[model samples]
Target: MEISKNIRESKKNILLLANKKNKGHIPSAFSIINFVYLFYENKLNINNDFILSKGHGCLALYSVLEHFNYITTEVFFSFGDFDSILGGHPHLRKNNEIKASTGSLGHGLPIAVGKALAAKINQSSKKIFCLIGDGEANEGTTWESAILADNLKLNNLICIVDNNQSQNRSIPTPNLQKKFSSFGWDVITIDGHNSNEILSVFNLNTINPLCVIMNTKKGKGIADMESNFQEWHHKGITDNLLKLYIKEIHEEAIS
Candidate 1:
């Protein structure tokens, strides 16, 4: 669980940076932390491509990259600053490790499909992994990409839905597994925070593209924030709240 420890540390840093910069997608970011963590720690293989389709969750991705030494603490702390390249959303130029620059909802899947198709045409064995938020799924482009992925039989394409059940207005999403299954995807539903279940989906072998619907809480790992997810969706952290987050992470790190 060293990766989990690293993630906790990264979250603490992200909060501190957010407090300094006065901007962050805290709830969205925390929700997908475990998904991103397990993807890099246990699922990512050589030449594999990963797309953060849920661009608002970039803080989690940024923190994970920093944890892996792809970015420095100085660069991470500069997030959202006027002169910094790192914004609320991820930019590929800011960090080459990011496969795609995404902030517009529903675009990541199509891009991932294209990448998967290119690998298919070249007969390359690279797999394309894209993480989409349940809210992002509201876009028609997502469904279109899903259909295209199934039509192309892009077995190398894997789409993970971070079904946190809280969208722009805190509205709940539909049954993602049923929706994806209807589109001919090999769908799997699991607790998003569980690393073992998340890792197991990577082992699935099928002719169609894979879709993992991860049922997750919007603000996981932090108690007060967890219940007040809508409020913290894109809220800035205060110094007092930052202290509490640091304390919570530290407690979890040891427990």
Candidate 2:
């Protein structure tokens, strides 16, 4: 796999975090953890905000947040527990580093559009970076927000689509780059699992609202989960299965 230690750890962390309370969208988290981990690893400029719009992947966010000390290890461990701030979604953790309470699929982009517009109006140097799932693209709000962002000339807004295509069986969004370009966004597609590609794309300076379509597989790194991710989407992991996943991840990452 040639993945970074952070990626391996973050993947393992999500499993451990989910196994603790028998909760979490592990496959969803796995699909985007690398991006999230890299976002923190690079210590991305926070002049604005980063929204994990696909909030079912909270375990991935929490895992990297802990790794980067955005949230304490204690808080990370309290995931899905009684009286805990961490839940299956970020809507509950208003006090944490989270910028928006996301979970309801299509809301984050609209909110991001609002933030980027506000930044433009105030003449601030803030750039709003948002990560949305391919499935979330099925929502009208996603397209509406994109159109509005481009109309406003929101070069400060960067939207990254986690195009894992986990929802293709329902409604597939074919030619995402073409679609975003038609809406006036500068588009770039990349290998989502490749760290070098991830960093290169994120570093690019855009002249218009940008749409980065990161091609990825659901439940990446682990072959078993990657093959049948629908079953693992929100499944509670048994201890045996968890061990198997950990071992597989280690073998792949080390190979």
Q: Which candidate is the best by TM-score?
A: 2
Candidate 2 lDDT tens digits, 73-143:
89888887777788778963454468789988998899989999999999998888899999999999999
Give per-residue CA lDDT, model 1, range 166-227, as digits (tens): 77465556878888899999988888877778778877877899998888878677887788
- Model 2 weakest 10-residue run by lDDT: 246-255
Segments in model 1 whose C-alpha atoms lie over 4 Å from true places: 43-45, 168-171, 253-255
Once fitted onto the true fold, the runs of candidate 2 whose alpha carbons sit more than 4 angstroms away are 1-3
Q: What is the TM-score of each candidate against the true structure?
A: 0.94, 0.94
Q: Residue 4 of candidate 2: its Cα lDDT?
A: 78
Total backbone collisions for each predicted model: 0, 0
Q: Report model 1's TM-score to 2 decimal places.
A: 0.94
